[model samples]
Target: MNENMNTSTIRGPLDHEIRDQIISAATEHFSHYGYEKTTVSDLAKAIGFSKAYIYKFFESKQAIGAVICTNRLAMIMEIVDAAIAGAPTASEKLRCLFRSISEAGSDLFFHDRKLYDIAAVASRDQWPSAVAHQVRIRAIIQQILLDGRASGEFERKTPLDEATKAIFLIILPYVNPAQLQYNLDTAPEAAVHLPALILRSLAP
Candidate 1:
């Protein structure tokens, strides 16, 4: 599905109540049955609606999956933001960000394996939700680097954009759903030690 396609162009009027009902039902269905196994027809049957009715709100099965994926990523960012807000310094905030991401990914993997599978597919398919989530994460990292440099806590010699990209790459294994499981065994140690190493390199 073309993620950029406007909903209004293809779908019916999005009545908030109806949309919520559909999304709520879909979430339960996806959580229990897994994304790939569930079809739009299955969702409609579960919600007591016709297949055509479901299509009025979502263009395709992937479209519905996109909404669920977006919500999950948003929740992760909220947790990350709260972690950053609680830390007193930019360096500490950066550390919190790293740790929070690793923790969040682990939580999803162990507690919500079905949803994690959806995220893995989204990441692998380059879905818009996954792409947008990565962009938001990088922006947060960039802001932290900017703050650190302003406070003389981090080196000013490195270009801000370069530094942000480097840090984002370092954290990608934990952040990318497709790559997360492979590194889970080492994530706990890396989450602690990697930030320390990055902080040392950034120190003024």
Candidate 2:
């Protein structure tokens, strides 16, 4: 049985159940087949729905694709929030979120071929939502830096915005397009070095 199917009916959250199935199937298809290769019909089949049912739920493939973006963003935010809760300092929180983002990449949506295809599409086409998500992440990092300054953990002279975004700028080129691309083994070292590197900007 496909994990993406629902047998129960007659409910509110259960209606949401079908939507979840659709998302799961679309994720697999996109990750496995890529944007151009994955079809609405395949998505419908994966969700155990008829073509008409898919149309009833989503106006088009693009609509479902947009939902994919929404789901991916939500997953990333959940990780960030959870990481921040466990972190003691703003700098640590920032590191936590970066690590969280990297970790979330390994989840079904990001690491899977169907899911990575969305990222590939965004990278290739320069999708606005993808760009927006990146901006928000950079902003979040900057906010952490500013807070660290308030606590005297970061240098007063550090340009938080630039330094925050620069972290990604530094890592972007060497990153592998496939998988989560975290130095999971080296992440603890990075967690330490990353904060220090940002704090360096504040040094006199």
| Cα RMSDs, all models | 1.7, 7.2
Tell me which residue pairs clash in candidate 2.
30-114, 31-113, 31-114, 31-115, 32-114, 155-202
Candidate 2: worst-modelled 10 consecutive residues by lDDT: 1-10
Off by over 4 Å in 1: 1-10
Q: Which window of ten consecutive residues has the lowest lDDT sum in model 1?
A: 1-10
Q: Give per-candidate clash totals.
A: 0, 6
> Considering every candidate listed, which one attains the maximal lDDT?
1
- Off-target runs (Cα >4 Å) in candidate 2 are 1-21, 28-34, 45-53, 107-111, 158-160, 171-192
Task: For residues 92-203, write the lDDT of model 1, one tens digit per residue.
Answer: 9999999999999889889888888888889988887899889999999999998998998999999889999999999999999999989999999999999999999999
Error of 2 at 11 (Å): 21
Error of 1 at 45 (Å): 1.8
